[model samples]
Target: MVSKEKLNRINELSKKSKEEGLNTAEKEEQHELRTEYLKVFRERFKKKLDSIEIVDDETGNNT
Candidate 1:
């Protein structure tokens, strides 16, 4: 999971972007944070999908 601080920074950067704009450094930081956030989210989602069990009631078999 991404840390609270990074998440907070991501929000802050977004607000700043809409309100005024971000400098190059801030934009880079925001991009990095977003990428990290997505990576973590996708990994967790994949894990959940992998854990799912599908069963056929008629055959009493698990796939």
Candidate 2:
């Protein structure tokens, strides 16, 4: 079984990964817009995801 300390570290890393992923995605979309590669699509997709309720499914609260 994972130790509590290790579990907490894993959870922290997971949260960081999610935030990093979102940042990278935003940058990529920005580049796509600059290059005229469906800027509207990129913006729309990001907008939809931004509107998502940031809740853990099981806990029904923020992660």
Highest lDDT, which number? Answer: 1
Model 1 spans with C-alpha error above 4 angstroms: none
- In model 1, the worst 10-residue window by lDDT is 54-63
Q: lDDT tens digits, residues 42-63, model 2?
A: 7778999988777788988885
Across 1-63, the per-residue lDDT of candidate 1 in tens digits comes to 999999999999999999999999999999999999999999999999999999999997996
Candidate lDDT values, in order: 0.96, 0.58
Tell me model 1's lDDT, rounded to 2 decimals.
Answer: 0.96
Ten residues in sequence with the least summed lDDT for candidate 2: 29-38
Q: How many clashing residue pairs appear in each of the predictions shown? A: 0, 0
